[model samples]
Structures are given as structure tokens and as C-alpha cells.
Target: MAELVLDPESHFPEELGIYFWLYPYWDQVSVRGCGYMVRWGTPPLVISILKFTPLAFMVTWNAHPGFTIPHTNLCDFIVGNGAAPVDLPLGFSNIPPQRYPEAPGDEGIVLHTPLAYIAERSK
Candidate 1:
């Protein structure tokens, strides 16, 4: 489990985005899926419940897929007190990532598009 605590005073007043890449070893099923949750000033939000096929992981690490923080119900989340801890907890599951939240099956080999957010926010 990796937790990222964003300092509001230093990070706020502007929108922020997160991105990552997964490169599981080809030997076996490196991971069942990856879970991401955000705890801002308000109630916690589940950002992503993602998985990959074995074929996806078997490729060269450099060829692994890139993932961006999708736009979920986060627009309202941006409007916050900027005092409470803004926590981002990311994890991988060999079993289920969490029980209360059930993950979906077979998200396919590539999770997200290769496009990035430019200054104009164009794809």
C-alpha cells in the first residue's frame, strides 16, 4: 500500500492530476488488479479498480501501459477546505484489493489511452 498525503497549502487552489504505469513481471499473474482511493476533505472516493491480462504484463516493462487519473466524480472534490488531509492510497491485489468494494473482471490489456493533458487539455 502506498499512501500519498498532499499538503493543501502547497498544492491547492489549482487542479492536480496523477499518472502511473504498471509493469508486472511475466513469470506469473503479477497482480489481480490495482486499487486507488482518495480521502480529501469530504468522504473518500474510489478512483479506480483496474486489472490487466497476463499477456499485457509479459511484454517488456518499457512497453507497459500508462495510466492517467481519470475524471470521475472529482470535480466537486476539488472544492475543499484545503485543511483536511488529502490522501491518495494506491494498492495492488493478489486476492481482492478490498472486501467492501468488489472489483470487476477483465479490464483488458491496456487500461488508459496514451494521450496526455496538454495546456489546452486537448487529447
Candidate 2:
């Protein structure tokens, strides 16, 4: 299981739309056990993964209508206080930066993680 920890430095000053696209090699995968911890106030995070294929999906987040608090101060509530653990299938390898065929000009950041969660399995 791979859990996403929203680091304090990665927190956004305001509500920003974030997204992630995943394409695995497994026949099927499941994501469960999502929760949050309350600090000074509720963190803005409500993630939902829409699985389009057996090994492909898109990650999305929707802030709670009531948790509309601006992140003006660093001492205030943290961003992404609540993140879920993603259950990855077996035999997953590395995640190399391949040019997205659809968007060859697009580029993304490389995140350093202990576990190989967001990796592509060689067919």
C-alpha cells in the first residue's frame, strides 16, 4: 500500500486545482482507507479516483463547501491534511519520465518517494 503524505512545503497558498493521471499494468486495482486529521481547522482535501481502465485512472479532489478557509498564514491550517493510502498491485517497477504522446510539450515534477507507487509496469 502506498500512502500520499501532503508535505507542508507543497501546500498551496490558495485553493488550486490539482490532478494526477495513473496508468498501471495490473488487471485491476483498488484504492481504500481515506481519512483526514484536524489541525487548527479542517484541511482542504477530498480525493476521488475515477478508474477508467483496469490499470488506468485519474485522481481528483473536491474541497468541502464548508471548509473554505484561506491559507494566508503558514501557522494556519495545513493543506492536504487528509490523504489516503493507495493500494498498488504486485510486480510494479519504475516510473520513468516518458513524453506524453498526447501532450509532448507537457512536463511534470518528479516526486521522491520511499515506495514505488506511481510507477508503470512493463508489459
Candidate 3:
């Protein structure tokens, strides 16, 4: 497995007002009729270190042979106020290194979440 590192200087989305990191793994498999398919595996199975709450989060994936299988490629994370949401962000390289506008309140917390997603391929 290759390691994907996040640039500490990167900025989170203004709408979300939080920073996040993503790690992805890809596995290849062979289908009976299909020539090849990619099966995304589970996340790294580790909790994010950063502590921050989030309104909601989502994950999406794409493959070369689109829609050959009957799998839905959308994943979502919804966190309420009571519990603190993971600090990680969504999608690999989704948040680029840049500056973000400060939130309305100065005391507002800046959260950084780390999330991992896995995908599989069939050959």
C-alpha cells in the first residue's frame, strides 16, 4: 500500500470551515463475465487524531468501466452537535493547499479530520 500524506498548510473548504485528510486503497479482482473490475476496500480502520465537530460529510468514487456492477459509490457521514465529528476531510486531494477565510466567530473551533476510503478493481 502506498502512503498518502496531507500537506499541513492546506486549507479546508469555506462552506465547511474545517480541514480534512483522506487515504485510499485499491484492490483488483476478476469477475465472471466482466473483463476487469476495481473493488474499493475498507478504510485504514484508524481514528482521526484531530478533534472537531462537523455538520456532515460525504465520499464518492469513480471507476473506468462505469456502472457495470450494481454497487452504489456514494458514502456519507452525518454528525450531530452532541458528538464531535472526525477532523478529516472528504476525497483524496479534494482540499488543496491554500488559505481559507476565518469563520464568523473568533472562538470557533478549527477542526481537522482524517478519513480513509477503499476501492476494489476486478480483472
TM-score of each: 0.20, 0.23, 0.15
Report residue 61 deviation for candidate 1 (angstroms).
Answer: 19
Against the true structure, what is every candidate's RMSD? 15.9, 15.4, 20.0
Candidate 3: regions farther than 4 A off = 1-76, 79-89, 102-123
Report the candidate with higher lDDT, 1 versus 3.
1
The candidate that achieves the highest lDDT relative to the unseen native structure: 2
lDDT of 3: 0.25
Ten-residue stretch with the least lDDT total in model 1: 55-64
The digit string of per-residue lDDT tens for model 1 on 1-123 reads: 111245434433232332222324322122322332232232222232222322121111111123333322222334454355554333344333221122233432223223311122134
* Cα lDDT tens digits for candidate 3, 45-89: 111122123211122223233323222221223243313455433
Clashing pairs in 1: none
Report lDDT (CA) for all predictions: 0.28, 0.32, 0.25
Candidate number with the higher lDDT (1 or 2): 2
Ranking by lDDT: 2, 1, 3
lDDT for position 115 in model 3? 30
Give the CA lDDT, 0 to 100, for residue 8 in model 2. 32
